[model samples]
Target: MRKLLICILSAVLLFFQARAQENIQLKSGDLIFQNLDCGPLCDAINAVTQGYQGNKFSHMGMVLLRNDSVLIIEASGKNVHLTPLKTFLSKSAHPHYVGRLKPAYQKLIPTALAFSMAQMGVLYDDQYLYNNGKYYCSELIYDAFKAANKNKPFFKLFPMTYKEPGSGAYFPVWKVYFEHLNMEVPEGKPGCNPGGISLSDKIDILGQYK
Candidate 1:
């Protein structure tokens, strides 16, 4: 069918794009930002948050250089795990952007990555609550650096808003989302998101994967 052919063509383009990014000299603790295209819920998340340089991001992961291999440590799927860089890029609909810590903060890389590696197999936090013993994408990275900073907060957590910014009402998607989880929305809970971290002054955007 024509639709199937179009899908195949798209896949091919993404594959080559992922391959091209191999030239980028990725280092451990580098952040990889992504727009997951995960539909309405993702759109709602971005609606309340913004990224650096006018970019849009909803998911993020840290680069891990281990044993001469490149991997991305992200809290996705059922738990925290390392995904190959190519696989990570292929999952994104937008060009992958990389972020590196400033010189002073680069020293935290080892300790931060160590903390993250120890969290392998941790549960994914669908509730999006901070310090809930489950790791969400950005929360995992936030806490890793926090631990590296001797329990001091690295990226600041804002009062999470699941509602429309100025209208003072919950996004219908979030209303249904939490209702299905059988819990009230944690509107004012302290939390961090990819978009928020993207705007952090501690790191410098190093350009796109292309």
Candidate 2:
């Protein structure tokens, strides 16, 4: 009877340990993500930009995923202007550049929008681009290290949740700041305004920090 009780207790402890390892929480900005699987995701992004050696494209963000929770870390870029998608679309010469976006590129849309709003610290440009005053859209990079990890579990390129009607909340630095202060996340109509939804109309995932 004693041996059986010990075995049962050991099984219960193992179950709880497994559960504990399933998910990780990134509550603070200083937390560094070491378990992030970057192999497969980076490969995927590289596949899209074959032979491209642009400096802007080389720089990327870091993302960590443990179980359901995912942490996105936005690092400062060198000489890169964070350009918004709407601004780019408005100025785009192509006819088929609005509303109609490729699914594969959706993961990049928010970062691109935020980049647009981010103040341009330094000036950098690609050889292909001609504009001296405005920045190009191709300079943004999405690091896919999680996708590359075959052995470890990783979140999808675009991490999303099903709690809300559409995609969860999205905000610029200002909006995120306000939200962090325990005030309401600015919610107005979607349009070309600071309070408006810069990205998709979908709701934002609650736990993830901007």
Q: Which candidate is the best by lDDT?
A: 1
lDDT of 2 at 29: 16
| Weakest lDDT window of 10 consecutive positions for candidate 1 | 15-24
Per-model C-alpha lDDT, please?
A: 0.92, 0.30
State the lDDT of candidate 2 residue by residue for 72-172, as single tens digits: 33333335443332332233232211121233534544444343335245344322122243222222222121222332322212221112224454324
Cα lDDT over the full model 1: 0.92
Q: What's model 2's TM-score? A: 0.19
* TM of each candidate vs. truth: 0.88, 0.19
Q: What C-alpha lDDT, on a 0 to 100 scale, does residue 165 get in candidate 1?
A: 86
lDDT of 1 by residue, 70-130 (tens): 8999999899999988898889768778999999999999999999999999999999998
Query: Lowest-scoring 10 consecutive residues by lDDT in candidate 2?
Result: 189-198
Instruction: Tell me the deviation in Å of residue 159 in model 2.
Output: 30
